[model samples]
Target chain A: MGELLPLMLQGAWVTLQITFWASLLAIACAVLGALGRLSPFAPLRWFSITYIEVFRGTSLLVQLFWLYFVLPMPPFHVELSAFSVAVLGLGLHIGAYGAEVMRGAIRSVAPGQYEASLALNMTPLTRFRRIILPQALLAAIPPGTNLLIELLKNTSLVSLITLSDLAFRARQLDQATFMTLEIFGLTLVLYFLMAQAINLAMRLVERRLGRGRIKGGLA
Target chain B: MSMQQRFDDSPMVRPSRRDGSAEPLVRFDQVTKRYGSLTVLDQLNLEVSPGEKVAIIGPSGSGKSTLLRALMTLETIDDGVIEVDGEPLTHMPTAGGHLIPANARHQRRIRGRIGMVFQSFNLFPHMNALQNVIEAPVQVLGMSKAEASQRGEELLAMVGLEDKLGHYPAQLSGGQQQRVAIARALAMRPKVMLFDEVTSALDPELCGEVLNVIRQLGEAHNLTMLMVTHQMGFAREFADRVCFFYKGRIHEQGTPEELFGNPREERTQAFLSAVNEAH
Candidate 1:
């Protein structure tokens, strides 16, 4: 049982690494998608909204399976590892969710901000870079931080496809050693620790961004 | 930073005007503005020379604000052209001297010379007083931060807002915010400045300070000013000329003495009497 603890810990580390890489991909996709949807041009808006709706409408499991099985085996072919497939699939799915959250945050920026930027004769690009992005990021952090935590938990579901995350190791250790209680209990503790740490860090970030607006911030 | 271009040739807003060439600094030629079916401005014609301070007064919905907004290009003209310094506002000519109307980029280039201070003082809430003043000069006018900061300091000093530069808009009182807004507008070094009821949103006691700042700016800066105000006494004191609008058109316009003391139009007479009757 104790031996299984070290293996589970190793798997937990790998799981966290995947979550971090996937979140980086997801946030990049989020910034691009939100900008597309919010663009003044109709074509970009239509393309972004369509991409989000289609991805969000499908099941995440189906997306993972497709990314793993279908995308690599086409007559015009490319190949990737199971871990990469899982991360890309999860990121793609949540990137859609993150885009919507970003859109909502951007919409909440007061109309005066837009008018004020226009009054200054600001170019559209400069306006977004300076005024719109700063305010939108401040508004986006609270809900977005929670979404990232949910993304970490959902990474466990990828262990079903043999990416060897914590949940996969837990099942294997329970089967080999018949010490299900201690091994599975340790896995649960690891997830709790990881998720709580992420939550706490994000709360700190939210406080800094939302300063002066909220009283007793982070509480 | 360099005042060379605007001041080099006799410093006239219209070179022809002060030079006796008679070019109008701003002209609204038979302009009409409509929102859906409601005509806010109808076939309005007006002219102001370089450095003229014109105050427009009427009850709400008389389209005075809309008129100023149209000049700033914040609101598009439905029917006519706005000319600034002998140039048509929405377009310019190529080197060949062929007249081509402007695209968004060109419009932005020309609109650079116009500044507006809103009644609500729409300072960016996330920005502190200093950033709000410096943003346009740094971004739109392409000044470096150090240069922008120096210019911003001068403007804040002009508005008596040097002490409040570190505070955010939400922290400042209404009058202070409006003064900061005036500084922001001035930082652009715009030839034309538009004020849409600048004092209407301030407290009665605070209104005097902001108005005084504006009066000084009007006198000191060679700016073409278009203002919409309801403060009769301030209008009488500050305006080089007064335009009394009724419904959607100017009922009468003249110097303050001619407009206030010897208004020839019946509508102007009634408006002046009602306003002065307010104790």
Candidate 2:
């Protein structure tokens, strides 16, 4: 148990790194995808819909496998590290879902807001940045927190892609010590603690944003 | 009968005879608007001179609101030109003698000179009353924060919301929120103001306060104002010219004495009677 603890901590570190990177990538994709969907240009809207559908329709495991295994072959030959592939796979998968959440939030903002901004003669960019986006961000936070927690859970899948995440370490330690029950139990607790941390961080953000408006609860 | 005689005998609001050569502040030159198969406003021709207060009263679906919305550029028209301050707002003229739909940049540039207050009091819920008034000035007009805040305080005070500057729209009463909306619109110093039933959403008791503010603005300010209102008394008292719209056209328009005191059209008489019954 003493020797395995150190190895498990190292694996946890990798899990944290992957979650952090993947979360950032997911947010970027979500924002771009949402903007594209709302854009007036037909080609941009089409490209965005295609990207969201292709990522969301397929299986995450297959996507990770393709990124890690298939791309290295002759025709594509676009090799990536296991860590990068894990980030790309998880980020793109969750991002497709998050895009709809983002679009819905933006649309949920009252039509009166757009008209008021127009009456004030605000430029489109100024209206989005100053009026529309801030209100939409508050609306998006609840669903966004859910997506982020899901992203954290999905990091466990990176182990199958040869990434030494916490799940990977748990399996390795169980086989070595033959204390499968104790190792797996500890792993479950570890994942719970990580999720709790995310909840705490997101709650603080929600509180800060919920100051001016009335709707969202503190929890 | 004697009260009616007295109202008719009182001096009417004289129409402004501004510089004879100056263009009207707003002109809807044969404007036609549509929504799919429905024609919202059909070949609507109207004019508003600077410092003139025009009240539009009509039954529901008579295209009264659309007329103001068209001037605000909130709705697009299918044909005809909407000119503000003698310049086209809905279209821009090309060098080859053609009129094309104005782009967003051009629309915004023209729309800046007009301010609109909605029936719902469309104040930004996220911002306090003061911030709502200052937002346009600081962002669109590029006024310094200090300057905008100073002007914002003055506008809020004008609307009798001096103490509620820090309150969000939700915290204020409907009447107070509408007043804030007025302040927010006025902050832009628009050459023309459009009020689309600004007091319709307020309680009956609350309506007086908003109307009072508008009355004061009408008496003191030189801005051109167009109000689509259901308040018959306020319309009679405040407007220089009262237009009774029916079926997408001004069925009858004249001085308040001429229209409200003695409407010539049968539709106008029916509409006014129905409104008076509700009142």
Candidate 3:
């Protein structure tokens, strides 16, 4: 039991790194995908729809396997490490879901806001950056928090690709020591703690974004 | 002056055209706008001088709001040309003296001289009152933040919201929000200001506060103003000219006394009587 602690903590560190890097990549993809979906140009709109449908419609595990197993063969001879494959696969998968969330939030802004921005002679870029994006982001945060927690849990899937994540370490320790209850229970607590951390961070962000409209709250 | 010569000179070099003497500041020449089969504005021809106050009154769906929306570039006119300050709004002039559809850049440049306030008081919900007022000045006009903040404070003070500078739109009353909206529009220093039923959304008591601010503005500034309103009593006192619109055209127009006191057209009389009964 004492020996299992250090290995599990090391595995947890790997899990944390994957979650951090993949989330950054996911955010980038989500913003690009959402804006592309709403773009006026036809080709960009089509591309966004295709990317979203393809990533979201297929199984996420198969996506991981394809990036890890299939890409290094024949016509598409691209090679990557197990960590890169895990981050790319998880980021792309979660990004498709985040894109829809962002698009709905962007559309939910009142038409009058756009008209007010136009009346002020705001350039399209300034209007989005200043007026539209801030309002849309406020609407996006609650749902976005859910997607992020899912991404953190999904990091367990990286174990299958030979990465030594928390889940991988638990299985190895379980086989070696045959103490399933002790190791797995501790693993659950660690995962829960990390998820709660994400929840707290997102709530703080939502409060900051909504500070202007909320009365009697900290400015 | 020949049309070509007028086009050749810079827009700033043009003479100040005011009140039945020089050229009109705003002209809608046979302007037509249609939303599908419904003709919202039917070949509307109107002229406004540089410092005139025109009140547009009509029943719902009479195209009064549509007329203001067209001038503000919120709605595209289906045909004819709308000109502001001796330049085309819906079209751009080429060096060869041809008029083509105005692009986004051209429209922005032309519409920069105009401002509008909506009945809904569409202030940005996430920004405080002073932020809303100074947003365009800092972003669009490239004014420094300090200078824009100074102007924003003064404008908010003018609208009687000096104490509520940090309040967001959700924190303010309907009338207070509309005043902030007015201050936001005025911060741009537009030559023409369009008010589209600005007081209709407020309660009767609140309407007095907003109307008083507008009356002060009219007395203090030489701005050319156009208001589409349902308030006949306010129009009678505030407007230089009152236009009665019916079925996408100005049915009759005259001084407020001539039009409201003795409406010549039967439609105008019926509309006024109907409006008077509502109050």
**Each prediction's DockQ?**
0.40, 0.40, 0.54
Best by DockQ: 3
Sort all candidates by DockQ, best to worst: 3, 2, 1
Question: Interface-residue RMSD per candidate?
Answer: 4.9, 4.2, 4.1
Which candidate leads in TM-score?
3
Q: Scoring only the second chain, what is candidate 3's TM-score?
A: 0.94
Best prediction by lDDT: 3
Of the true interface contacts, each candidate retains a share of: 0.38, 0.57, 0.63
The parts of candidate 2 lying over 4 Å away from their true place are: A1-4, A216-219, B1-22
Residue B222 shift from truth in candidate 1, angstroms? 1.6
Colliding pairs, model 3: none
- Considering summed lDDT, which 10 consecutive residues are worst modelled in model 1 chain B? B9-18
Model 1: runs farther than 4 Å from truth? A1-5, A211-219, B1-22, B93-101, B276-279
User: Candidate 1 - CAPRI tier?
Assistant: acceptable
lDDT of 3 by residue, A1-219 (tens): 789899999999999899888888887788789999999999999999999999999988899999998999978999999999999999999999999998998999889899999999999999999998888888888898899899999999999999999999999999999999999999999899988988898889888778667554321
Model 3 misplacement above 4 A: A214-219, B1-20
Whole-model lDDT per candidate: 0.83, 0.88, 0.91
Q: In candidate 1, which residue pairs get closer than 3 Å at backbone N, Cα or C atoms, i.e. clash?
A: none
